[model samples]
Target: MAVLAQDGGLAFYGEPDEAREWFRADRIEDIYLRLAEAEEHEWAGRFGAAPAPAPGPAIGAFRQWVLLTRRSLDLLTRNRLTLAVLLGSPLMVLAMFAVLFRPGAFSPESPSPAATVMILFWIAFGGFFFGLTYGLLQICNELPVLRRERLTGLRITPYVLAKATVLLPLLAVVDALMLGVLRALDRLPAMGWGTYGELFVTLLLCSLAALALGLLVSAAVTDPAQATMALPMLCFPQVLFVGAILPVPVMAAPGRWLSCAMSNRWAFEGLGHSLGVERLWATGRSPLGPPLLDSYGDTFSRAPVVDWAMLGGFTALFLVGACLVLTRRT
Candidate 1:
């Protein structure tokens, strides 16, 4: 069988000359020379170069990566509690509050139900605090395991892609639930399909930004205890600086600069603006103020600035930084 293995599909098994059909001619010659030299180093019973392994389907590089990604996602799903908490807690809390508070408190007119739902769900639930909790948790939990898997030849990019893919659906469900509750309570405006698309994009981007930062920290940190200790420091400052509760322009100069560095600031600003909260702020009517861009007082005002742009930029920075750290040789 071993002999037959070397004859057909395994024609290149031990002979460099056989490699010509599979590899470039020059490459075959170079491999042949190396094989010949390696033969000299063979022990009493061993061949210098072991027979080449059998090839399978001509899967492309991306297809191989997808397979790897699917494997990682399968592993993640098996850890149901972790996945559930990571994706479910925020939505659960939001629903609880909507149940507890009078629907009128969140209206776009006063505290606008639409405004409160958008802010708490997207900005507070998914943005700053989620980044702190989920980001740190994902890293502290996954980094070491991933590092071991990577050392065994698994690709980091595929793993990241898989994890991100698994996360998106959960985020979508959360966004939908919150959006549904607000709408059912008559808190949201008569949104067209476009509004749903915009909200999904904004929330997903926010989740990615948080997830990336968490992975970056996980890859960079040496200890899990230290990561746990650091999460609140990362989260609390972000909440204070993101203008969820305060106007960025009104902050002390140092605080303003701090807000510039906080992903939460951009997220809340973008989400707030996208939901028409900034319009109130702009027209000097909102409890919060000095929104990042143009604001109007119309009931269904367009954002003075694009929220997606800020979210895209922040998410890109975090993902790139995380990839760099994850792919670095350890």
Candidate 2:
């Protein structure tokens, strides 16, 4: 046998004349085989010198999360219409509430308990609505792509988390804007920054919990239309049972129990507590204050911290549900 040497130090062992003939005969299979064997050897030599270790699960997972988060953020930013709607809806709500409520609604001298109730409930619900709209279309829109990616080691947790990681910051911005706009428009009472900070934190938690719930619903649904339909179903219950329209104390047992499950209930109570609404109403001269407080029955008397814990619990529960649903579907 004759050894034919290529320029790259790769060699083919055969009769030299036969090798030339093989090349000239238009035998594509022989040419391909020879090239594949050469490439394999090249790869072997390159890898043999210092083999690279495969990434550990933790590292791989982290990398996947980062990439997925970036992709989600990119997608979120590219949709100008959605971004406008998400940011604008809260502003619209702020304007409506500002027009509806007088400036001294929560003032100590002349508190309007009804106004306080509406303010807290609307702000809390605004946060929840922001989060829900942000997350409702996230999973269902990408189900096919996600299903394919899942086959290639894409994890459900990272997918769900990436969606949250991208949207949560936007949600925070929306929450802050909502508060600032309300305060600027005199819909919110003047207060120290510390109290405002507490309120902001409360709203952000509520938004996070709602975002997780939306993610869960998004993961469970098959299409964007279904998720869209779910919006009213989710929001109506949240609106009706959050103890703002009808006090939880006055609701039927089942309705009261259902109110407990609405994240907005905790959010409304938390905002009210943080803003000292109970004190404002209890000591104010408004004739409706005392009776309203009686109906509410210490709804805002608890520490905002308790409401924070409840919101956090709801967030975790919903996220776990979203992950499980994704896992099952994929």
Candidate 3:
């Protein structure tokens, strides 16, 4: 008998006369049955072993979250240029704004409506811009690796949360610095600790919402270049429709409706209300104050808690979107 390999199995290949001599008709069935059994045994030995047991769901999930978060933090720390940009850009923005606005802009005694508005705009949008930049490139840059890991049982929730976990604290630090620096420069008025805490919470929520938006964009896009291109597209609406540049009441009907959707609008309004922009601008000595207040038209009249709720809603919405996109892709 001549053994030949054919289609991943052993076969007998010989001249017709040789094959006829090797196995007569009566024995051929038995010989073929034995050969089939042997092949089955060989295949079972090579490839049919039982899989290893998986860990319990709770333990597995915890382990995955810790590992992924640590890995993400490590990756963030190692990227020096990105880290520098994240920390530096906000400081630069703060410095430029400080120069642009006069001191005591938002003070109750001598408020500058324009200056107060500008200061509030920058604070809210600064946190937003920082969060956006931090998260925009995160997922798209590591999609291939994420895809590979997903095959080994990666969960989208943990993956996204890990990214957020590593960056949220960093965002807090950046925000504190922004506020601290401006206050030190006398660009922002000193406030009670309770008021400052309220402002910080508002800014932090804005950053969280923006970060979620960035991650959503990152997951939906195919590459970092696409995400980078999307940055201005995302930011322009936030800046234009947030009622800072153009008061919401003054916007066209469609623009008015759109302004409601901008997270920055809520954050801007929240900060303004928290800092008494309405009272400051409406009653202050500046002639421009009342007109600006008229235009704003109850924009900041709502409670800061309402803005906080809206911001939390946006954050949840974007995070859900990111997870859905990642699940579909991976």
> Which pairs, if any, clash in model 3?
none
lDDT of 3: 0.85
lDDT-wise, the better of 1 and 3 is: 3
Q: Assess candidate 2 and give its TM-score to the true structure.
A: 0.81
Q: Where in model 1 is the C-alpha error above 4 Å?
A: 1-61, 99-101, 106-124, 139-153, 186-190, 278-305
Q: Which residue ranges in model 2 land beyond 4 Å of their true spot? A: 1-59
lDDT (10s digit) by residue, model 3, range 197-273: 88999999999999999999999999988999999999999999999899999999999999989999999999988
What tens-digit string does per-residue lDDT give for candidate 1 at 35-84?
44443333212322565556555655477578866775786789898777
Give the Cα lDDT of each candidate: 0.58, 0.84, 0.85
Better of 1 and 2 by lDDT: 2
